[model samples]
Target: MRIFVPGDAAAIALGADDVAQAIQNAAARRGLPVEIVRNGSRGMVWLEPLVEAETPAGRIAYGPVEPAAVSGLFEAGFFEGGAHPLRIGRPEDHPFLKRQTRLAFARCGITDPLSLDDYRAHGGLKGLERALAIGPAATVEEVVNSGLRGRGGAGFPTGIKWRTVAETKAQQKYIVCNADEGDSGTFADRMMMEGDPFCLIEGMAIAGIATGATKGYIYIRSEYPHAVAAMREAVRRARKAGFLGERLPGSTHSFDMEVRVGAGAYVCGEETALLDSLEGKRGQVRAKPPLPAHVGLFGKPTVINNVISLASVPFILAEGGAAYRDFGMGRSRGTMPIQLAGNIKHGGLFETAFGITLGELVDDIGGGTASGRPVKAVQVGGPLGAYFPRALFGTPFDYEAFAAADGLIGHGGIVVFDDTVNMLEQARFAFEFCAFESCGKCTPCRIGSKRGAETIDKIRGGIDPGANLALVQELCETMKFGSLCALGGFTPYPVLSAIRHFPEDFGTAAHLAAAE
Candidate 1:
């Protein structure tokens, strides 16, 4: 019998390793034959360390499994899909899994990340194969038709970025995958890298082919050691299997790639900053007169895309652009792997077509706050994303829709908060984060973030509340329009949103009452 246990970092942190070992020991004591396979997470984080037993019916899941319960699980016949209190039935049949429209993450959590055979069995390499057959120009055109935008905060069209790189004249072109996902409450990039390394590899290979680039690099964050290791091993396996390095099988173009780890710097998540860090320089944003596409890595044309943007390419290539395009609402045409985190009860990754309402995600999908209190606010995007109160919960999860509502779908990370949350403090945290993570290149970000935090503290302390609030607002506008990168420009999002939606939290309600 084959048993599956997640090797995902989240699962590991939840004691999946111990559970796997316990299962092995239990099987050994029982004299039962069991082949344990460490696979990627199925995106159901609340049920992590979710163990699955292969049976005639399919993969039966038992989740949040502890090592101490392994003997009981064995006694209860868990290996043969026997009845157990921990049993969650088939993973895919779970309400959380059943609802998702997983495209890029289809093979994640389902396959052994290191097994090329496992990847191939689940429709891997098909996109690269199609790309190889169709050639670069058509490959570029296919992505253009797909209407996929970058999933790493920026809503820039992935096709337009690729077309720029493809059309540029350069002796040495490059494809750079931005794996430096530094946004708060975002883990999709890490999950994808650890769960389905080959999918990323295949995606990057497709990108290299599409952009006429012979070399690619995945700039992963150092915090994701598991992801970095998994990707490195996957790259070795892919290279040996002829999927990378020199000419790919059945293709004339030669493409190769390597994984590089970055120091823990939030600024590096920016495209230009990432390119700088990749070039052995301090992670600082570059001015945008010449975008990365025109003169990128090593002064050559480059295609720098977010992890999800590139990962989605394999599906687009294998299934055709229109097929992927058929999923989402206007402009936001495709699936977004929305991450539910913070005070949510059913916290996990939910990949679905765009247009799902914020209320549906926060209430129906996320199962409300874990604290069982009314959700006060939900921060969509990342730390820089706007803090949306229950009033704006009607907003759709689309690029234009979120922007229209004075928010952004930055990295698709939704952090829920109960009524106990202090919006003033949350806004303060955003400024502090920007201040601490700023690259110190520009005055607005370097000076404004620190000032913003100080001003928020003054409001919290009831020091000239009205004037301080106005000062904070002015500081935000300066940072928004004057900052060099998103570190400062986007810092105002959470702060202004908090002041706008939760004025009471800033001690303004009592003052207004007194004045009246």
Candidate 2:
């Protein structure tokens, strides 16, 4: 009998370790032969500690399992796919999992993350193999043909960036993977690293070939210890298997990579700021004229991309770029790994083609608010992302579409808020977050964020409510246009969106109380 339990950090936090032990003990007690496979999460977070039993029909799942329930599960004939109170049937058929158009996350949750054999079994390294066979120019052409834009908030074309670095002349070209996922409603980067570290490694290798970059670095956030550890192990195994290191299996090209942990600063998520942090300096946003492709990382031409963007490379090379380009709507081509978070009932990772409306994500897939209250606002992107009122729920999940609605699909993190939430408090929190996390390199961000917080406090305290609202708007505009990095530039998104969509929540204390 085969039993699968997640080793993903989110699952571990929810008592998956104890549950795995329980399943092992129970099987031993019953004298039944069993093989327990520790796999990555399927991204169905709410149903974590989801134990799957392999049977002839398919993999049967039981969710949110506890150690105490192991004996009951076994007695219910869980091994033979017998019915149980916790059984969720095939997890794929569940609405949350079935609705996704998983491309980047295809191998996630389905395989033992550390197992190279399992990765190969699930069609891993196929892209790298293809890239090796086709050579660098054609490999780059494949990515360029694919309509993959940067998944790291910027939405820049990945192929274009790679082409720039590829065309640049440098003695030492670098490929840097930005894994410092510091956004409030984001965990896709950490989850991807922990779930399928090899896919990232493979993607980086492909990038090296495309850009003539022999060295690569994955700058992950310090908070993701599990991801760091998993990536380290994956790199060790890949090197041993000849899938990485000095030379390729069937080609003359050579590439190498290592994992570098960040100081957990939000600004480090920016590509240039990340370059500074990677160089053992304080993390601060750099001016853009040079663009990382021309001059970056110790004054060498470099290729920088987010975790998701690089991970998508393997798929593009393996299946051809046109296949991916055909998935999404308009300019937002290919799939997006939209993360459902906050007050949503079925909050998890939903990888679907771009163009799905915000309403479908919140109401249909998320199944509405977890509190059963009406959803008041949905924040797309991270904390710096704009808040969407129910009236704009029809907004499509595309870069241009969100931008048209005065929003952004930055990193595809959707944080839902219920009716009980006060938008004013949320707006205040946005400024407060910016002040705390800001790198303090620029005046507008350093001073403006503090002033923004104080202004919001004044409005809340009933000090010239009318004037304060206008003052806050003025401050938001300054930060929006003058701030050095996104930390301050995008801070206005939440602040302005709150005031525009939910005016009742702002102003004097009496007004707030009346709204409540």
Candidate 3:
């Protein structure tokens, strides 16, 4: 019997390691032969330690399982594969798994990511095939029509960025995948890199094809050691299979990829800083206008896209652009792989077409907080993202709606906080976090953030509380205008949002009461 089990970090942490070993032991004692393939996560993290046994109908899922239960599968004749209590029918049939509009994540959980035949069978290089046939201009048009934007906070149009690189006449061009997922609660990039390394490879290849770039780099964070291993293995597999490297199957396009490990800096996720780091220099932000498209990566025309943005490309090439554009509302076309995290009841990856509200994502999908207290505030985007009170929960989780509501969906990282959470403390942490993580390139972000933290602490102690509040407001404004990067510019979102939304929580008496 062929059994599929994921080796996702979260699943392994939940004892998938023991479960896999147990399954092996069960087969050995039963005198039954079993083929176990450890695949990447399917993104349904809640159902992790999810084991799948191939049955006559489809792959049956047995999830969140314990090692002790492995013997039961053998007694139940799971290898011959009759239904078991742990069986949730087909893996695809689960509600959370079923509702997803998985374009970029198409090959994520389903395929043996390393297998060329498996990837091809599942519509993998059909995009590269089509791109090789139609050529670059047509490829760019399809991307433009797809209406896909960068999943990274900026939300820049990906197609337009590609066109700039394609048009720029240069001897060298580069394609960089910014996979340094530094946002507090965001992990879509990490999950995708870990779960489906090939999709990212394919996406980068497509980006190279469209823009006439010969080399690519995936800037993954050092935090994800397993993902690094998976990506490295995938690269080896791709080159061996002729899916990557010179003369990619059925095409003359010669492209190569390298995985660059990040130094755990949040600001490095920004394209400019990422480029600086990639160039073997201190990760400092460069001024814009000579954007990455024209002058990037050692003075070459380069295309730098977020992990999700690049991963979405293969699907755009395989399926028509119109199909992708059909999903989302307004200009924010196509599905977004929204990462739900922090104190959330059903926190995991939820990918859908744009248009859902904060209310739906937080209450309906998340099932409220894990603590079961009333959710006090929701941090949309990241540390730099705005913290919306219950009043703004009605706001749609889209670019325009969020901006109109005095917030930014920076990275689609919705960190839900319960009533027990202190907004003032959370606000203080935001400044503290920025103070530590800021790249020290600009004055407003470098100095203002540290001072802001000190100022917030003074307010917490009721040491000239009214004066401290005024100081914070002034500092936030200065950072907003004076900072060159979002690190400083958007820090004010969390600080001001907390002050504005939960005024009572910031009072000295309230702080004293909480301590008592």
- Models 1 onward score TM values of 0.98, 0.98, 0.96
Name the lDDT value of residue 394 in candidate 3: 87
For model 3, the superposed segments whose C-alpha errors exceed 4 Å read 80-85, 508-516
Tens digit of lDDT per residue, candidate 2, span 389-476? 9999999999999999999999999999999999989999999999998888898889888999999998888888878888888988
Better of 1 and 3 by TM-score: 1
TM-score of 2: 0.98
- Model 3 residue 380 CA deviation (Å) reads 1.3
TM-score of 3: 0.96
The local distance difference test score of model 3 is 0.86
Ranking by lDDT: 1, 2, 3
lDDT (C-alpha, whole model) for all candidates: 0.93, 0.92, 0.86
State the lDDT of candidate 1 residue by residue for 93-160, as single tens digits: 99999999999999998999999999999999999999999999999999999999999989899989
List candidate 2 segments past 4 Å from native.
508-516
lDDT of 3 by residue, 192-265 (tens): 87777888898898889889998999998899888888889888898888777997777788889999899888
